[model samples]
Target: MADFRTVPFLPTAFHDDATLDLDGQAALAATVAAAGVDGVNVLGLTTGEVTSLRVEEIGDVVAATRRGAAGLPVGVGLGPPGAGTLALARAAAAAGADLLVAPVPAGSDPLAPLGEVAELGLPLWLHHHPAVTGARRSGDELAALATEIGAAVVVVEEAPPGDLLAVLAGGASAGVGGLAALFLPEEVEAGAVGTVAGCAVPERLVEVVARYRAEDAGAAWDAYLELLPWLRLEVGSPGLRVRKEAWRQRGVLSSGRVREGAPLAAASKLAITRRLRQVGADVSAPYPGS
Candidate 1:
């Protein structure tokens, strides 16, 4: 399986008018790569805005990310199930995505689609987030699917530490969301391979993982604590508005514009900025509507 330690779920870049910003997405991808993350996953809930983008647009984003990734492995999330999903998978592969990230389909055996996706020739990372997909499977079932489909990794969310450990023990590479930053130390100790997070602070996430790998548990814990507040603020948020705002403040993105119906409140922006500053982030960059 491909190693995916410290993968940051990137946010799609947009102009002040919320139009797709291909160049901006490339720039963000470059920035994340420069920050030393192990890999980058585009078109996921936070980054690619998968639901809103068409297949061609997703291909554009994948190609843009490929350009900015400095040759790092780029993974693209497979959007909703449909005829387009396979086409998008092919497009992503042609655009240089090294792997596929997708949730197991709701209400049916996931093997068929998963097997077909694996046939695309890129390693598949099965996403197991029940809240979003509204589908739940036992560890054995998930492992069976992974084993059957030859999945390279499984991204899980809202699973207890024991459950997460159990998934890993089942002989499948596992990545966790939710309390990833908080549980990272223990998870890493227990052999969890990676984490899919929207912490907006790639450097810190990279540092924590690096510290743990270096056997510096003390420093890793400190870094995790510093990032805890930001993670708390991000989890359960409606969209990537706060994360995009942080990126804008730090000059990683041109604007924090989100699609319609995912607006970022002014109060929320101010609060995010305050929290970022408290953690010593540089937020002096110019932003839209300034």
Candidate 2:
């Protein structure tokens, strides 16, 4: 069995833009890698809407994410399956992706697809976003899938923070989501291998996890509590935009524009700014959303 106790999944950070024109993508990837996050999952619905990125563009993003991650794992998000999924997986392998993060399909057989990926020898990280895919899997389902596929290198991201513990208590591989920042200590205490969150503040996460493991749960939870409002602000309909803007505001990235339908309105920006201040984010200028 693969030990995931120390794994930390990171969301790929990029400029808020319609399409990353190679240069933009590369720059953002480097920024996240330099920020010292553990691993990165790219071309997923979180960075930008997956549907908006062209197949070729997806390859470009993978290449860029690889560059950004440097020696760390650059996990690519494989999709709804069919030709597109296969094509992306092949491209990701060719471009040097370290792992493939994906949602388990409802109708398809995970064993076959996982076997195909295993033939390529790429690690698989399971991502569960019930809201987007409308396909939900329990911890038992995830564990069964992982065990059947011999995928010890696994990642699980579910929404509605409260439910994650139930899944972890049931023994999934890793608990991954923005909620991880808030609930990781409890999940870890309850036997989660590791966690992934979309807060774009890997340093903070690393610190909190270190503190928690050091038996300083109070300090860990305190840090998490301080950052919860920030997480809520950076997520939701325009999470990518808010997150990139926060990164840019902190000098991590250049832009904060996401693709169509991810607009950062004035009210939204103000809300993010207020939340950041409430959480005591240190910066000269207000976050981009503000």
Candidate 3:
């Protein structure tokens, strides 16, 4: 099973015309791999825009991420909710995914779908994000599901500090999704295996994990604090447009254009760029289109 302790769900980059920019996506993956993340997750809420992508697109993204990861373990978030989940799982596996991530299927019996996904023979990373999936499972329920499906990891989204601590205390190798980097030290101290942020500045996030693992609590806290403003901005935004823009400012992506949306205001872009620079992100280049 792939170690998901410090996985970063990558943001999918797009050209100004809204087509998937595969090269940009590859560069983003390669950047994270170079930064020393434990693994990479694609096609997730902030990264893949899973619900908006077609089945074939999902496969393409997975394949592209695999290529860019350069042998780092790659996990694919199963795209969208549908009867086609099994097919999607197969596509992801075929495209070289080392792990499959998905929410418990919505139904009278979520376990049945969970079983179906487990049958695909890849390690599972069960996602519990009530805000997105509209389903909440107790910690005991999650542990039981892990046991049943043999999940390698569990992603708890929007988890408060206490809830995250509780999950770790239960001995589940859990990761937090969304803007909770401040909790990284506490979570690591409480036994969190990793964190999953869709931040554009992956190197900083990676440093946060590395410092903590190196037992440099002060350094880790400082690194996480440096990322707090960006994380707060991300959590408050609706989608990954800001993140893509941030990457564009860093020259990791060709452009920040999200599919079917106006570009962020020039002032907002400038502000984000300045904030990123203040936090020591490598934003030496000018923002695209500035």
Candidate 4:
């Protein structure tokens, strides 16, 4: 595991749905860095839709974000077969990505992709999504990987509470840096280096990270609890569809319509609106103090 103390896990921002048209992507990236967040992650599960974007489009998004970030470290999310991951990593590197994140395919050697990209010498963030990756690596497995690499392997962003806690315990034991949970603010307080749920609300996400850094655990926890309903409403509901819609309502994205499989339903929209109001989220505005 990479040194968690050294690499702070920042929220991974999503691309705009149809509502924002094409400009939402660059805008979101700037919005994140302008807030003083440590870094911005592109091509995330929430944005870029991994398998959906063409290689060129991926590179375009990375470049646009790099320009918008000005100086913030831009991370590129790489997924799938090692070869594909290597290609994306190289492109991100060319586009000035500060870091790279990839999921180690299950059943296959987790070390394979790591080895492929090891030569790049860029900071690496590994994903620990058991559901997507299929197999889970024990703390011992992760520690051994880090030991073998000699390069920093940052935090593991695992999902679900049970898996996240287990990974955290394992990562702590392995001395691999820190662990990241999906969007569970409570677990973040317990010592989840940072989170990767930037799709729902970028400003709020920055606030959560700031609160965590300031050691305002109580306020951080409260902020997370306040938004828990909205967070839950977003999980696996509809690809980029709902996310784009949420961002649109917040005035961050131009619109909320996503690709084919990501259509939003009326009921889901109502649920999202209810949760946002319940949390006192200013859907009519973007960011804090705006």
What is the C-alpha local distance difference test score of each model? Answer: 0.74, 0.62, 0.74, 0.58
Judged by whole-model lDDT over C-alpha atoms, candidate 1 comes out at 0.74
Model 3 per-residue lDDT tens digits across residues 31-65? 98888888889887545777666777777888788
TM-score of 2: 0.82
- Tens-digit lDDT track of model 1 for 1-290: 13437777788888888788888888988988988887888877444578787677777888888888988888888865656678788888988888998777777677777778899878888887776677787777777777888886777664455465556653855545434355666666555677777567777778777877777789878988888787667665554777788888888788888765567777777777777776666777633343
- Model 3 shows how many backbone clashes? 1
Error of 1 at 115 (Å): 1.5
Error of 4 at 13 (Å): 10
Q: Each prediction's TM-score against the native?
A: 0.90, 0.82, 0.90, 0.78
CA deviation > 4 Å runs, candidate 1 = 1-4, 170-182, 286-290
Listed per candidate, the RMSD to the true structure in angstroms reads: 2.8, 3.6, 2.8, 5.1
Q: Which stretches of candidate 3 lie over 4 Å from their true place?
A: 1-4, 168-182, 288-290
Model 4 C-alpha lDDT per residue in residues 1-290, reported as the tens digit of each score:
11122222222234443222335666766666666666767776434566666566667777777776767777787865446788888887888888787665677466777777767988776655555657577655665566665434434545434344445553523222222224455445344444454545555655655666677778867776666666666656463566666666767666565544545666767666666667666677432332
Clashes of each: 4, 5, 1, 11
Clashing pairs in 3: 5-194
As for model 3, its CA RMSD to the true structure in angstroms is 2.8
TM-score of 1: 0.90
